[model samples]
Target chain A: MLNSYSSADKVLLAVDCIIFGFDHEGLKILLIKRDFEPEKGKWSLMGGFLRKDEVLDSAAIRILDNYTGLQDIYMEQLYTYSEINRDPVERTISVAYYALINIENHNAELTQNYHAQWFSVAQAPKLIFDHDSMVEHAIRRLRYRTSIKPVGFELLPEKFTMRQLLELYEAILSKELDKRNFISKINSLDILVKLEEKDMMSSRKGSYLYTFDKEKYDAKLLNDFVLNL
Target chain B: MLNSYSSADKVLLAVDCIIFGFDHEGLKILLIKRDFEPEKGKWSLMGGFLRKDEVLDSAAIRILDNYTGLQDIYMEQLYTYSEINRDPVERTISVAYYALINIENHNAELTQNYHAQWFSVAQAPKLIFDHDSMVEHAIRRLRYRTSIKPVGFELLPEKFTMRQLLELYEAILSKELDKRNFISKINSLDILVKLEEKDMMSSRKGSYLYTFDKEKYDAKLLNDFVLNL
Candidate 1:
């Protein structure tokens, strides 16, 4: 039966990662300067060809680990770019993935070795191929996913201040949300555990810290809870 | 530069479509009996291999047209499945697309010629390969997409009564909805032009007909509106 597919066309398969991070600066994407390619020296998303034995998920994870030296990141398959001329060198269909990683957790040496840097999504430089369009689609998916799931937590530290949480949401949403409304909405979700500890990073009066109640979050996943702004 | 990619392994690419339809019955999916080797005579999705000169979107559209003889249907690329042993015959990565179509509009003769049948999503038969999983994923996506966009209109007629619209939502969500609440929520969207004409199908008094205001729906697409039950 394998012989039946012999006459079918074969094409190169590649996986691209749009690694998003959030911190005091804003939402940022990890990009590497391509050392070898048809478009060498251009900034592009960290990517590689899919190995024969690996599945798409494993391929995406492998690519991310190769550059970030990070594991167990929250990643999703975004979309596939299959324009006949998307790749100038070959007819490669690239499956894109968006990963949410804690900005502070990645290995600095690995990034430095690969000439990788994080740029604020808005200030991202020109990317090779259709990578700019990939980034745009990823941002849209991130926004839509954040509204339905508590995925924004992936970009934040385990213990974070309400101000940090608000900032993270604002960054992902790319908008300024009213503090009171935001706090009230978060409170209504009842999935946050307000800690007695405070973080004195921003003001003389420290803001209270909070952690996501994973148990509650997991339960909420079974229901239709829309985090409307 | 093209020679640089010669070392990379190539794989066969295929596109499978989960064609969804709705009529007076309920939410349904189009399934076809396999007519070739490997999965001969077993139920499968409408699928085909990608041609060297075509893109993924074009491949999907072509496959759908070949099976259904319908063009310009509402389709979305759902996901890519790439397990090592997913295709027993060869190493093939299948990209799944879900299409919404009006059941009454499809070519009846074409469907019969292709051995195609529409089964209620809940009662769909056991399909070959990972097709059952593909159908499950498509339904989940359809539920999510219908909530954010007015895509349910694609499964309905150009002019339909409020009863038909309510039934469509009921079938998609697979749950009963409060009639007054559903109508009020849809009315608030203000993307439906209610016609003075009536359809006497459900009741003798006749129900008012309504058509989707495309201009208004397009504008609504720019905003974040959740049509919650």
Candidate 2:
């Protein structure tokens, strides 16, 4: 290779993931206690240094997989943070990715092995370095993504009740939405298919279950639609 | 410094900018012919390697200023491209930023010095490296930003006609929008202040010009609104 860029300064690159999961409780984020210095024992997003031969997307996937033992999760690159001293131990530019995974799907053993735990996004601990800001940024991105993409479905079970879907949006938006208006707005997008199945656990009169119509949802994705919440 | 991350690999980071500008002709991007080795004379986005001491945002601003002699332009980080060998000269990861500028405000002399020229995004020649992909990504982001934020105003003059605004959206969306629907949707945002001043360039009766109400626009930005183009 021609050493054309030899004069350029090189810096360490890190990939960090904000793993968002949803449950009956609310929106949650997976965090782990750092096992090594300089911020050992402190809560931080699952992260690792990017290897020379790895692409950033792969690095994020690797980091997430290493922590959760989950593969093919819905992940999107949120933003890159390069605050000069964001990583005090080195000059590191970290690319932050946000992943949406069904809360029930992660391996409990793997998570426990890494000292990883899920905390409600509203109640997550003050994280180390710039991670708190990263989480805040990721939440904002998640809320925005909820409007344009069917990403919320990634955090829900294969079959979900209307109330569950509404709760998921409310959690992601961090606010209360009128149930009627929310359902109407969501239905207007024409991405959900009402299933004959019902969940008897939530009410005396069970509520109907619905699953995202993948074909229509994908078609809507290609021709973007706005869902005013 | 602790050097706790001493074993981590270091790679060169580059900041490339897609400078979007608008005029009577339509939407355009600023491109420069590479004067350096490997891809000399090939058109590419204005870019530079990030310095060790500089933050990524500062690097983006500095690169933009260097190429256009413009400052404080509206710029946002779009995405980072790290394909291991995206740059043939080195293992360089580039953070792409999209900048919106008024076409008339750039320093023509400075641009000429760097062999920079404006090309309609639709008609621009093939760019070197992964820059073509970078431009495409930036355009997608710019469209997303347009719906949530009043960033489209950055590419327009301080005062513009309703027709000009419609044309701007059409260019960014790459589709002709219904004039009535576009006007009503924009008026509903209530972010524009119609002025007594009129531009007679396109019509004998003259078209009323409007400017963004900065306070309302900023407020709307804080409480995000959707503008479906």
Q: Which candidate is the best by lDDT?
A: 1
For model 2, what is the C-alpha lDDT against the true structure? 0.79
Q: Candidate 2: misplaced stretches above 4 Å? A: A1-4, A107-111, A221-229, B1-4, B107-111, B221-229
Q: What share of the true interface contacts does candidate 2 keep?
A: 0.50
DockQ of each: 0.41, 0.44
lDDT of 2 by residue, B139-175 (tens): 8877775655545556678898898888887777777
| Cα distance off (Å), candidate 2, residue B178 | 2.4
Tens-digit per-residue lDDT, A1-229, candidate 1: 2124878899999999899887777789989878786889899998899999999999998887786676787688999889999898889999999876668766554555556788989999999999999999998887776665556566677888878888877888888888887787778778899999888886899888899999887876322452110
Docking class of 2: acceptable
Which stretches of model 1 miss by more than 4 angstroms? A1-4, A107-111, A221-223, A226-229, B1-4, B107-111, B188-190, B213-216, B220-223, B226-229
Window of ten residues with lowest summed lDDT in model 1 chain B: B220-229
